[model samples]
Target chain A: MSGADTVVWMVQNAGSEAGSREVRVCGPALGPDLRLARLDEERLGPYSPGIYAEALSALIAGERGEERERRTIVLLPHTYQVAEFAPLLAVQLGAAYIPSICGAGREAEGGGLRFRRAILQAKLQAEVRPRARTVVATLQSGAFGSDEPPASPTRVVDVCLPADMERSHERQILGREAAGAGGVDLAGAERIVTAGRGVGGADQVSVAADLASALGAELGASRPVVDNGWLPREHQVGSSGHTVAPSLYVALGVSGSIQHLMGMSGSRVIVAINKDPEAPIFSVAHYGIVGDLHEVAPALTRLLNERAARRRS
Target chain B: MLPRRQTGEWGLRIGVCIKQVPDTDAHPRIADSGRHVDDRDVNWVISSCDLCALEEALLLIEAAEQAGGGRPELVAFSLGPARVEEALRKALALGADRAVHLLDDGFQGGDALADGRALAAALRREECDLVIAGAQSDDLGQAATPAVLAQVLGRPYAWLVMAVDLEREHRSVRVLRELEAGMNEVLRLELPAVLAVQAGINKPRFASLRGTLQARRKPLERMDSSSLGLDPESVGKAGAGIETTAIRLPPTGGGGLLIDNASPEAAAAELIAHLEREALL
Candidate 1:
C-alpha cells in the first residue's frame, strides 16, 4: 500500500460492467479502499498517445485537487504500452516521471519518498528523490514481492474527459504482426547455455555453442547477441523473449540486463563466466568465474568430453 | 502543429537529438559527491541508440532523394558542455546538414523534464517537420526526455520505433513499433511528429575520410539559454522534478560463490567438481 489512503485503478479500454467485476475480484491487493475507472476504448477508439495522455492527465489532476495536502503517487506497471505514454502524462500534470523503479521507501531525514532504480545497465543502483508535488512511477517487472491484502469494497467512479475532447487525427494504428517465428522453445529446457555480447562477434558464437553441445543444453542468447545478428530471434531469452526456469543455466560472458535477469533468475542453479568482475550477471549467478571465456569454455569442453569417453570405456 | 518552415527547394527537414554519454564499456568511478559518475577520465562517445536514430534519419533522406522527392536536409541537435560539440561534429560527418549545440551553464544538472523543456524551445526555433531521438540513454536509461519533449512541443510521438516509412508526399509516416512478447504494432502519424528510435533497426555507418574532412568546414551553431529565450530558473537544477541523491554498486544475489582466479584448467576442474557434487553434470 506504501501508506496510501486510497488506490484508484484503471483498466485501459475495459468495458464498464465487466471492468468493475474484474476490479472487485483482483483490486484488493492494491489497498483496503479502492476506486475503479475505465478508459473505455469503445468510446475513445484505438490506442493513441495523445488521447491516452490527455485522458489520464485530466483524471490524475482531478484526483490531485481532491487530495491536495497529501502526497499523491501514481503507480503503474511498467510495460511497453505504459512506456510510450506515461512520460507525456507526467509532463501534462507537471509531475515527476520515474520509470522502472525497483523499490521505494520514506527517507529517514526529511521523510521524503525515495525510489531505487537500476542505472548503467544494472551495474549500479541510483536513489531518486522527486522534487514535485505529484509523482508518476512505473514499477519494474518482478521487483517487489507480493503480499496478501485485507478485503475491501470497491466503489466505481466515472472520469469525464473535457467536453471538447476530440479523437486525435495525428496517428492511426494499421495493425500488428508477430516479431518472429516460434522455432525455439527455451521454457521447457532442462539446461540452458546463453551467449551474451562478450562472445565478441558472430564468428565467436561457436565457443558458447560448443560448450552447450558438451553439456547437452539448449543454446540461448541475450538480447544483444540476437540484436547484432549473431543468433536468430527465436534464440533470444529476455522479457521480450522466452522466460525459462531451468534446472541448470550457464551464462557465458553475459552482462545481465535487468530484463535478461527477469527471464532466467528463476533457474535452480546458475553459473556465470565473464571477464569483468563488476558485470551485473555475477550478481544473479550462484557460482561465477571471473575469467576469459575463450580460455575457460574450451577447457571445460575438453574435460567434459574426456569424462564422457572414460565412461564409455 | 507548427507550420512547416520555408526552404529553398527541399521542404522536408528532419532533426535528430544526439546525446554524448560516457562509454558503457568504461568502468566509471563514482564522484566524491556520490551524486553522479566521476567523468574526469571517462571516454565519451555518442550513445549507441542515438547513432541509430541518426542513421534512420539519413536513410529517410536518402530514400526521399532516390524517389525524386528532392534532397531533404537533416539537422542534428544536442545539449551539453563544449565536449558535446565533438558529438555534433561527428553527426555532421555522418551526414547531418547542420548542427546546433545548446551550450550554456544554465542547462547543467537538469533531469529529463527540465532538459526536455529546454530542448523543446530549441527545436521550436527550427520548426522541423520531424524530430527523432534515441529511446533511452546508455548511462541514465531514463527514457523520458523524448516523450516529454514531444508533449511540450505538442507533436504526436512514438517510442521504440523499429521501422519508419515516409510517404512520398511528405505529409505522413508509417512506423513499426516493438512491443512485448514478440508483438509489433504498425502506426501512421501525420507530419510534424517525434520518434524515439530503438537500436537494432539498422547498422549505423562509419564516417568516410571525405565526410570527416568536410565536417570541419560545415556550419556548427551554438545557442545559449538566452538565445533560445529560456529562463535560468526553468532550464536547470531549479526546474528539475527529480534529483539523483546517490549512486552505488548493485547488491549481489544469494548463494554467491566466486571461484578463485586460477589457471583455466584448474578453474574448469573445480567448476566440474562442483557440478558433479550438486548432481547437475
Candidate 2:
C-alpha cells in the first residue's frame, strides 16, 4: 500500500463551529486512521435541508491549510430517489450514477442479482455507482453508527469565495439561521434518551428528560411527538429530524417506525423500552424492556443515578 | 420574467430534481412474490409540489436571461430507471433548457439515504450556481434529499423555502422560510447555496402552447453509475448494508373501545371501571 505515491484525505467540513477556510482537492489516500482527541467530540448538526447543506459546505472546507490541501472531502447529501429519475439525471449533468431498487427485499449481501417481478411491475433491484473523479456516496443512513466521531488536529486554509448571484432565488435570510439553533440533536449525542408515542403525551416527556439528565444525555422525540406540538420540531427523530449516530441511545416508550428507526439505527448501543411486545423497535434494539414506560423510565433513572452515586462513593 | 430589469448581463445555471410518483390514490396489488405496483394503472403525475420548485427554476432562468446576462441553462435531472424518461422529458417540455438521466443497473433498490448519495455524487461533475429540488418525494415523503444533497455538494443550503429573491452584485438573497408552526421566517442567504422550496410557494404553471412545443427540442442527457466515480459495488441490494430480515405491515387498529350504557350514573361508572381495567386511569 505504501506504493501510494500521493495520499489525500477528504473531510466534510462546514460553518462557524468548524469554520470554512480550506480547500480539499481530490488526489490520493487519507493517510492514517483517525484518532479522536476528545471523547465528547461530536458532530451535532441541524435538520433543515438548507441549513444542513450550508453547514456541510463549511465543514468540508473548514479545516486548516494542510488538511484542506491534502484532503478530498465530499458532503453527505439528504435527498430522495425517484425510480425513473436517476438515470435521466445522470445524463443531464454529464455525471454517472448507479441506481438501486428497494422496499422490496433484503440484500443477500454477497449477490449481484435478484429474481423478482419479471418486468413491468416485475422489476429488479439495482444501484448507481459513479464513474467520475468526485464520488457522491449516498452513505447508508446508519453507517456512521454510535460513537464519538474522531477528530484530528489539522491546519486551516482560507480561500476567498466570489459571489454567485445569477439566479432569481434571492431571499434575504434572518433569525438564528439553521447553523446555531440548540435543541435535541441526538444524531451526534454521545448518549441519548428518546421518547415516542408510548411516552403517553407531552407531559410524560419530562420523565424521559429526567432519565436523559441522569445519563447526561440529550432528549429526543419521534415524529408523532413533534406533530402533536409536544416537542419542538428540532427534537423529532427519524427521516424528518436529524439522522443521528449516538453512542448510546435509550428509546423510551417509542414504537419504532421505519422512518424513526432509519434516523437512529446508527446508534452503537440501543436500549428500547416499550410496552408493546410486538413493537418493531425490538428488531434492531441491542436491549429491550417490554413494560409500561411510566413505570420503567423512572425506575431506570433512579437505578442509574444510584449506581453513579455508589461509584463516586 | 424581466431578467434585464434584475441582474443585467449575468446568468444562473439551475437544476431541478423531478420524481414521477404513482398517483397517491393507487392501491397495492400483491403477487405470489410480493406486492407489485402498476404505475400505468395509476396516473403518472409530476411530483405534486415539485411543480412549484420547477416553476421557480423556470422563472429564475427567464429573469436571468432577460437581464442580457450570463447564459441560464435549466437542466432537469431524473433519477429512476429508463421509465423515468417520461418525467425527465416532461420537465424539459415544461421549460427546462436540457435534461440529464442518472439511472443505472444497480440503482434500483434502497432507501432515501442511498438515493441522496447517488444524486449528490452525480452533481459533483457539473458546476452550477443553484440546485433547486422539491422538498420531498411523495411516496416515501422522506424530505431528506435537498439537505443531504447540500451536504454532499458541501454547499450551504436552506429548506421550506417559501420565496427566493436574488440580488446580483451584492451577492445576497431574500428568502421566506416556512416554520413548522404555520409561521414564516425570513432570511438572507449568500449565493452558492441550496434551497428546498415549500410546496405552493409559487404558482406552478401548466405547459404553455408554445412552450410545450419548444420542450421537445430540448436536449436530454443520459448516464449510468459506471460513468461516475462511485464505489462500483452495484448500488442496489448487492451493496446495501442493512437487510430487512422480515417486514410486516401494521394491522389496522381494530375498531376501538366499546362502552355499554344504561343509566347515566351506570354509564359513568362503566367508563370509569373500564379505564381502571385498562390501566388508563
Candidate 3:
C-alpha cells in the first residue's frame, strides 16, 4: 500500500471552459494524506510540443529533490493533450503513463495506488498499477461526479511561456474558428438528441432534429451521420469526435458502435430508439423503444409539444 | 522568419506514418493467450485515421504542384510485421512517391514509447520537411506515438489538426486544431515539424488502376531495428514500461427494460411514462 506524498494537477486552458471542470473532477482521486499542487496554464500561447515537454521536464526534475522514497502523481485534464504529453513527461521523469483513466484509488490489499481505465474502446475497464516511482495519467470526462468536496488548499504554480521557447520560431498562431460550420457546442448542452445511420437518409434527419427542438436538447449524431454529410463534424459523437457526458442522451436509430459508445457512455440517463431490438445501443440504454425512429420520433415530439401547449393554456 | 531559398527540386518532403489494422467491423476474437486478439482471420485495412493523414499529405503535394512550385515527395512510413507492407503499398498506390517499412521480429509487442523511439530513428534518416501521422491507432486507441516521436526528435508538434496550409516561401505551415466545445485553435509552425492528423480533414482518394500499377515500381525501402541503430535493450516488450495483464469484455449494462408497443403513439406514451416514473424528465 505505497502512497504518493504529493499530487500535481496539470490543467491546460486549450481555449475551452472544461479546464476548471477538469480540476474539480480529478480532485477526489487523491487520498486524504496526499498533498496537492497545481500547474496552471497562464496564457494561450502557441503550443510547441518540444518546449512544453522541456518546461515540464524541468518542473518535475526540480520536484524530485532530496526525497528518495517520494512518489508523485500528475493529473492532466484533457484526453488529447494527455495522450500527447503524458508519455513524453513519463519518459523524462521515469514515470508510468496511463491514458483515458476513469478512476483512481488506493489498492484495497497492497495499499499501492491503482488506476482504472477503459481499454478496447470503452468495452473493458482495467486496473493499472505503476511500475515506476512517479505516476502520470489523464482522466476521462464524466468519470467523476463534479459535486464532490472542493479540492484541498494547495500551492498554485504558473508555467510562464518563454518567449524564445518556440523552437527556433518553427511554430506560430494563425487563426481559429468555432468548430462545425453550424457552430454546435455539444459539450455544454444539458440534453442531447443524437441521430445515427439508422435515421434512414439526410432528409429524415429533420425527424431527429424536431425531437431535439421539442425537448430543448442539442442535436448530436454518430460518425456515419457526419461522414455522410448529414451533419457537420462538430455534431459527431464518438471516440474520434467529441466526448460528452450530458445529463440526458437520447440516441435515435443509433446502433451503438464501440466508437460511438466511448463518447456518450457517461450520460446520466440514456434512452435509445431503434427498430432493431438487437442493436448494441440497448445494452447501455436505461429505456429503449424497439420501433422505427421515423415513426416514434414524430409521435414523441407531438405528444410532448401537445402537453406543453395544454399546460400553457 | 527564416529567409526562403530559391525553390529547389522538391517543395516539401512530407513523411506520413501509417498502420495496418484489422477491420473494425470484424468481430474481434480473444486469442488463446488472452493478452491479444486472434487476428489471423480478420481482414486488414489501413487504419481509418491513417488514411486521413495520407490524404492530407497527398493534398499538400497536389497543392504545391498546382501552384507550379517545386515537386513535393510524399513518403509513407510504417512499423509492423510484414503484413504492414500491404498498407505501405496502398499508400503508394494512393499517390505517395515512396514507402519505408520498419520491419523486425524484435519490434513486436512494443509499447508506444519504444515504437516512437524506433520511428524517430527512422525519420532522422530521411530528409523530410514535415511529418504527419494519425492521431491514434484504431486497435490500441492510444494517441501517443507522434507526440513521443516529436519529443525524441526534438521537433515541435500538434495533434488533432482539422485543416492545414503551407507557406513554402516563409518556411512555415499553419494548421487548425480541433478543441473541445466546438472551438478550434489555429497555429503556425516552422518547417521540419510533426502533425498528428485527425479524421474528416479530407475525403481520401481511392487508387486508380493506373496508379495501382505505378505503385509497383515505386521505391519501397525495408529496414530492420539493427539498421536503425536502436539499442536492443531499449526496444520490444522488455523495454515497454507498461504491460497489459489481461483483456476482457467490459461489464454488461444493467438489464435494460424494452418497451415494444405495436403502435407509435403507444410507444411514445410508454416512453414518457417511463421517464416520468424514473424522474428523468
Candidate 4:
C-alpha cells in the first residue's frame, strides 16, 4: 500500500520549473477526496510544487466536503512493476478473487474465459447483485493521482522505497503520427460493404465494388481477402482485425468464424448473404439471404444502378 | 535525435485499445437455428487480459508523470456499438480522462481482417505514441489482431510482451517479448510502438468510488467510418475475402474404458479377457 502515513511517499519534482524541489505524498489524493479540511497546507513542498500543485489545489477546492476515506492505496512506481506488484495489490485492495475457477477452464474453451463464463453466465440470467466496494479495475494507459490520501496537497511527507526501479528493459513512447491520409476507417464507419471468401478472389471483388458503389459506402474485406492478397492489409475485419461499429454492415460470401464475428458483432444492422444457410455468419446477421452471391450481386447491382440512373433522369 | 527532457527525463503518451466482448458463458441467447450466439442479448464485459494492457499503459503514464513531470494523458478508446460506451466508461473509471468510440452501424458486418483495418485508422487519427492491447481476447482464440494491426499501420510491434519499461529518460523502451518457444526476446524499440500484452505483464487497478464518479464526467468522442472516408465494401462480413461454409457445435463423444481386475493373477487373466473383449490386445 502506498505509504498509509502521509509523510512516507515524498519525492522531488526534478523536471518542474522549481529546479530542486521535494513534495510529500501519503497516497493517491484526487480532487474528489475528502480527508483534510483545507487545500492549502504548509508542509507539501518548497513553494507548493508549482503548476502540479496549483492544478491540484484548484481541483480539490472544488469538492466542498465528501468522504474520501480509502482502506488502502497500492502505489506502483512504473509500468514494469505492475506484474510484480499485482498479487500484493490485490491483497491491499482486499479483492475476493477466485482463481482455479477460470485457470483450468480457459484452456478447454480454446483460450476464452472458461471459468468466469460458467459462474457469471449462470448468474447473469438473473440480476447481478452489486458485490463489494472492492472493484478490480484495469487502470487506463496514463494517470498517476496525487501523492497524499485526501487530506492535503501541500502536506509534505517522507517515504521508504519498497523496491527500487529495477526494470530489466527500458521503454518509452517517442511520438505518434498517422501512417498517411485516411481511406477507410472501418471501425468508425457508419455503413460498411464487406466481402468474404465467397467473393472468390481479386477477380471476384467486383461484386463488392458494385454494392459499395450503390450504397455510397466504404468497402471492407475479411481476413481471407488479405491472406489471399486480394485486399490490402487495411481492409481486413474481425477480432484479430479492425473492430468496426457501423450502422449497416453487409456480409457477402462470408462464413462467420467466432474470431471474425467478434469484430463486427457490434454493428447495429448486419446483412449477410451466403449460399450456406448454416454458415455462422447468419447467426449474428440481422438479415440473412440463403442465396448465391454470384446471382445476388448482379441482381442487386443492377437494381442499385437503375435506382441511381432514375435519380439522374 | 531522441526527444528528451532538458533535465534528462523522458515524457510519455500511451493509448489503450480495448474491446468489449460478450460474456460467452452467459449464453444470453441462441441464434434463430440455435447454434451461434445471439447478438441482441449477449451480456458484454470489458474483456479479459485486455485490462492488463490498460494497466501497463496507465502505469507507464503514471511513472513518466511522476519521474519527470512529462506525463501521458490517458486516452481510452473502443470501436463498437452505442452500448459499448458503457464499456468505454469502464476504462475511464480506471483513470483515462477521455475516450473515443467508433460507434457506427457501418462497422457491424465485416470479418476480422476488415475490423483491423478500421481500428488502425482510428489509432492513426489519435496519433498516440503507444498503443497497447491484450495479446489475445478471451472470447476469440485467434490471436491475430495485433499482428494485423501492426501490419496495416506499418509500425514495428511486439506480441506477447512480458515486460515493458521506459528507462533512463525514455529515449527508447526495453521490451521482454515471449516468442513462440517460450523464449524471451528483449529489444529496444525507438518509441511509439504497439505492444500486444500478456496477462502476467501487469497488475490492473481497482476502481475507487472517486474514479468511478469521475468517469461519468469524462468525455467520449464518437466518430464514424464515413467521416473517416472508408470504402463501405471493406467492412463487415461483406468485406471479408473469405467465406464460411457452415458453423455448428460438434457432437460430444463419451467413451469409458473398463479394466477387469479380479486378483493379481486373476487380474492378469481379467486384463487378457478385457483386451480380448475390446480387441485391444
Q: For residue A309, give model 2's deviation from the true position in Å.
A: 66
For candidate 4, lDDT tens digit of each residue in A1-313? 2223221122232223110111112223311221321212232222111222222223232221232443212122211222222222232233221111111111233222111211121112111111222212112111122332333344432221223222222232232323213576777777788899889889989889787877677788876676567777467676445668787777889876544665687676677777765565766675556667777666666665665798799
lDDT on C-alpha atoms for all candidate structures: 0.83, 0.53, 0.75, 0.53
Candidate 1 chain B: minimum summed lDDT over ten consecutive residues — where? B1-10
lDDT of 2 by residue, A1-313 (tens): 3212212222232332121111121111122322111101134222233322233233333432345333222322122322112222222222223222221111355322121111111111222222332222222233232233433424332322214412233333356334214654565678888888778787778989998898788888886677566787677666546667777787887777545766777676677767665565765676656666776677667766775798899
Worst 10 residues of 3 chain A by lDDT: A31-40
Residue-by-residue lDDT tens digits, candidate 1, B1-281: 13343433558889999899999888778899998999899989998989999999999988888877477778899999999999999999999988989998988989889999988998889878899999899988888999988999999999999999898564899999987767789999888999999888899999998999999988788888888888889878888989999998887766679998689889999999999998997
Select the stronger candidate by DockQ from 1 and 3.
Answer: 1
TM-score for each candidate, following the candidate numbering: 0.90, 0.46, 0.85, 0.43
Candidate 1 residue lDDT tens string, A1-313: 3335534453333532311232243344333445555566765567787887788778778776888775556655666777788899889888888888877666565456788899988978999999987788776766655333323445555545667898777888989997778766688899999999999999999999999999999999998899899998788888667878898999999999887987888798999999999998898898999999999999999999999889999
Mind sharing the TM-score for model 2?
Answer: 0.46
What would the per-residue lDDT of candidate 3 be over residues A1-313, giving only the tens digit for each residue? 3344655555544444443565555655554333333334445244555555556666666666656566667776644554566667766776667776767777577676777766544544556666666767776765556667546535555565545544456666666676667577787888999999889789889999999998899999997788778887879887557788888899999978655876898888899998876566887898899988888999999998997898899
- The per-residue C-alpha lDDT of model 1 at residue A13 equals 35
Cα misplacement distance, residue A159 of candidate 4 (Å): 57
Which candidate wins on lDDT?
1
Task: Give the Cα error of residue B119 in candidate 4, in Å.
Answer: 1.2
Q: List the residue pairs that clash in candidate 3.
A: A1-A110, A1-A111, A1-A112, A170-B190, A171-B189, A172-B188
Better of 1 and 3 by lDDT: 1
Index of the highest-DockQ prediction: 1
List per-model TM-scores for chain B: 0.93, 0.79, 0.91, 0.81
